[model samples]
Target chain A: MGEFPTVTDVARVAGVSRQTVSNVMNTPGIVKADTRARVEAAISALGYRPHASARRLRTRRSSTIGIRLDPMIDGISGSVLDRFLHALTEQADARGLRVLLFTATSPEDEISQFRRLNDGADVDGFVLTSTTADDPRTEWLLEQGIAFVTFGRPWRSDDFTAPRHPWVDVDGYSGLHAATRAQQDAGATRIAYIGWPSPSGTGDDRRRGWHDAMLERGDVSAEDLACLEVVTADGVDQGAAAMQQLARTAGGIDAVLCASDALALGAMIANPARVPVTGYDNTPIAAAIGLSSVDQPVDEVAAAALELLAGEFEGKSGAPSDPAPPPFRMVTPRLITRQFAAIPRDSVPVNALVSEVSR
Target chain B: MGEFPTVTDVARVAGVSRQTVSNVMNTPGIVKADTRARVEAAISALGYRPHASARRLRTRRSSTIGIRLDPMIDGISGSVLDRFLHALTEQADARGLRVLLFTATSPEDEISQFRRLNDGADVDGFVLTSTTADDPRTEWLLEQGIAFVTFGRPWRSDDFTAPRHPWVDVDGYSGLHAATRAQQDAGATRIAYIGWPSPSGTGDDRRRGWHDAMLERGDVSAEDLACLEVVTADGVDQGAAAMQQLARTAGGIDAVLCASDALALGAMIANPARVPVTGYDNTPIAAAIGLSSVDQPVDEVAAAALELLAGEFEGKSGAPSDPAPPPFRMVTPRLITRQFAAIPRDSVPVNALVSEVSR
Candidate 1:
């Protein structure tokens, strides 16, 4: 193997001391312009690159962000994470940071990886996704005094005024609320909702959006509301079954809103009433099928996560940190309305009512 | 921040010299069993982890694999890369290797990233994906004498008996051939194919599979072959348009096979004749919509790539290597047959002809 060019070689070629070369590479602003240019030219000519590990050892920072690549399960919804990861990688690259990917089978396994990475000082911080209520990962990271940010809120309590760590999450409730109101504005008298079973933080939040919208109408009684809402497991087939049950129980359904695109698709397929349906996550399939869906601003979420991490690292760099509120961003999602095309509308009676609604 | 435990602290706790501690960490087999256990216990108690950067510098090897995370376009087909990444991460982790992701806008940009990563010795090797004919990235890596494996063939020539570098690619020709034969077995007298425009190595290779199968049938004339083949850009809408064009130009397309699920879905939606359709890539949407498609064994591709890289690295470590042929694995893809359900079959006459054939 050929030997790689060293800093000494670059310094000799540039007619400068080794320290000047180091200054040119690490703190170019501190070096004279002419000397820095000369050093850079020599570096380019010799194809010299400073060892990342050696530099990291000196700075006590890896300039790398770590994230877990969860196993691919639901390809429909899993594309959300894929998009976010791409955005994060692009944003991190712009900020001179790299993303290191690791895999863990369980939360416990993830924590062990965190410890291993933390002990080695292999990464500056971590960006976590797929947060659940009272997430053990967050708790462990906080206790370890690790610098990290999550793409989801802690969901520990109803009051989201403060969190123990930094986080950024999309507002599912607001998204569904907008979807329901849009359906109401479209001259739909009866709108049914299909969602995941209770105890899910995200699902419950979205369901409340539809519930509140229905209550504001003042025409539907509590008994009617109960009849209009269907809670089932999150899947395409489960969604189809829920729609069937809703059609049998809830009279004359004019519209349906789902917690996810998977369920929304199922509802569209099984819709005998041919109601206009809205889904969450605005997935590729939703776009292909022309389903009106809620779109999470994943790029904004990634940017916010990085911003919080930057603030944390800046505070650790001996800056005079303010007694600020725990950092958090509740990004409102946008409703992407497309022409409903899952079923042929000419054969259904409700099509006349929904046709005039601007999509 | 609290001070992290160092080799000195571990050595003191284990009642050993710093050199002994280092030896224990680096080469446990060289240390006495009792001494190794004592050092390990001390490390566990102190929560000491050997510095990854320091170890890397000593060994001149970073146990990290670099890959460019291309921007997410065509979410339907893009899921293939997502799945491959997850599988690679899992397999690399099992081998004590890390996967580092970077974004590149073009081949030139990707090559620059390779240089940057290589200069720092930050990654041991790279795994290239999304190969095109005469890919400059592979050329640059080869010129630099870097250890790398590609998840795609070089595609520089028609004769793929040997290549410049180790690679593992799915056999697109076989996949399409099997898909065509499956349709024939299902009583499809006239089968049509929809694929991307030519000059795309992967696309053309897949097209050939269908072409060879039809040619072997002896029943399809050259003029009929031209009529049955539709070439266009890859998109759902494009697929739909292609299928329409086929229905107009080609008579009675009893079954259709697409180069991608996105195209197959389009053909299915636009099929007024209600023919069974198959897509490639066996994406989650295919399963959701019950579109039979070809499935790539990404897990196997990842394993093969890593195994090739290991062989390359082993050859570099003063081991006598065999004069073996350049490593390559043309993995055969599986034709996943699912019940076609994009359109209802009760009204279509073609359904009667296809119903007797097993799925």
Candidate 2:
């Protein structure tokens, strides 16, 4: 084998610490520009390259993360899972880890894959996504004592205070709270929410955000809340139908917020009354059509997820009483304001609806 | 360790060969239904599970295929690469091979990754995508005598008939030919094509298909061909610009075809000529907006690519002097006719341009 420059050599040439050199190569875009420039120059001058397998053998870690792809297609229009995979792979590359991709027809099938990949010692750990309430995979992995960090939060049907597995979830609640405030500030009095069917942790979180924001505003009536909140399956057709049903109500909704961009886009299309609509997951369609939506920090989610997963191997969060909350990383999502759909002047006001309509 | 049922147990229970049982597990969708049913019943009857690591120890194989994920995002509006990855992962799962994804910034960086992965005995083979002429990766893998199958055909710069590495490619030529025929059948004569600037194997194949089809139709003169065949960069704006330029030409093109759906979508938006446009890679936007497009058979491509890669390990085709050419497997793409955009008959044809302008 030809002689290759090492971390020490690169560090020496660049006049930087060994860790800095590692960081520069592993996470390319995040390094300081000047430090990156110096490290890159040193790398080019020395023609340095890190030997991954040698490092793997020395660490006794395969340096691979296992992920399962769903065999059946879901209704995610913008390929968010794909983007997440893209980001995860990039982050894994930066960290000198290989991503092992497999497919599962169901959650049980996924558990089978996890066992196989683990038994083979092919992967150091696994990264879980799209976690749901009473997740069987999480329960199984925990029982087997496998090292993993999920991209989504565990439902944890038991005590919420108990320390558990590491996880990173996008804060959909905060995004919706901000959206509700934005709607309030936009002269929308009779605001309505179209969320996915209940019992979903994500859906409930988003609904609570709206509820909390509305309570803080102190203007919404309890009767108004009961009239406006609706649940439906995720689809453009479903969103449109929900909105039409809301429109036929006595007071008539002045504005709408959806859990997804698909719903928002549909609402806008169905709106003859020009009700302002906002959606979550600022998808490509939302950006293309100028619909207001929320953008989840997928990049940050991947980074934090990797960091938490690595923490397991590093023994940073081994004991339940460690007090750091098991790196229960919660990433903040931001509101993306685009074509703000404004409510028309002639729209019936919620307060005056009974009188005006009765007359 | 508890003794678990293996492929032999399943085979014995199913009254079939072990290979048939393996096939039923891997490539589940492709196996004959009756065989699959029998193997499935056997699997359940015997409670048999293929122990991946045990099988690996026996075969001296890792049961993994390495793939490089590109960090830079492309102009594919709907994340076609992500969909391709999804399909590939599913297909690989069916074939009992896991896909290991890594990212490299350049060819040299990629070579470094390949070497590290190889030295570690991390994977059984490699799958290459987007092969270019004189591809450095291909050359290196070939020199090292690594078992690999590329999803793209190598640009044949040398002797066209020489024994080369195995590959699977979507037949862009046939897809374009079908598109041209579809347009011609829709009562269009002056068909103009907008393709990516070439020497790209894919671009060349698609352009040649259109060129040959136009010739077979025998309707286009050399001068007409010159005006019709336009080359530009890959983008919607570029397509709009190219179509606009084609519009200013003397004959006034009646039908348009694009190398990508992004370009076709752009042409539809910038349709001053009211030409019906057909696109390749029927993305989500195309399906939603009812744009006619060519759907590349991603599933078939993944299946064939896996089969060819496995063939190398199985010694299906061996030696340079062997009479049979490498399968060079080509999957066919089908033309998807959606809400077909038809030109308005009352709109001024190219022949009426002078009179309309004068008036």
lDDT of 1 by residue, A213-299 (tens): 888876577788888889988788777888889878888688999999989878877775567888899888787767778999899
TM-score of each: 0.83, 0.76
**Where is model 2 more than 4 Å wrong at Cα?**
A1-59, A72-75, A157-163, A218-220, A272-274, A316-324, A340-359, B1-58, B72-78, B157-160, B243-251, B272-274, B316-324, B340-359
Which digits, one per residue and each the tens of the lDDT, describe model 2 over residues B1-359?
11345778778888999888866654444577688788877765554544653344334467788998765354244456666777888888887878999988888888888887765567767888888888999988776656798888887853236537888888899999999988888788888999988778888899888888888898888667878978898766676677777878736777889998877766765675456788888766455445678888788888888888888877522332345655678788888876444322222122221121100
Question: Chain B alone, TM-score of each model?
Answer: 0.82, 0.76
Number of the top-ranking candidate, with TM-score as the measure: 1
**lDDT value for model 1:** 0.80
Q: Model 2: which residue pairs collide?
A: A26-A94, A276-A341, B26-B94, B27-B94
TM-score of chain B of 2: 0.76
lDDT of 2 at A200: 89
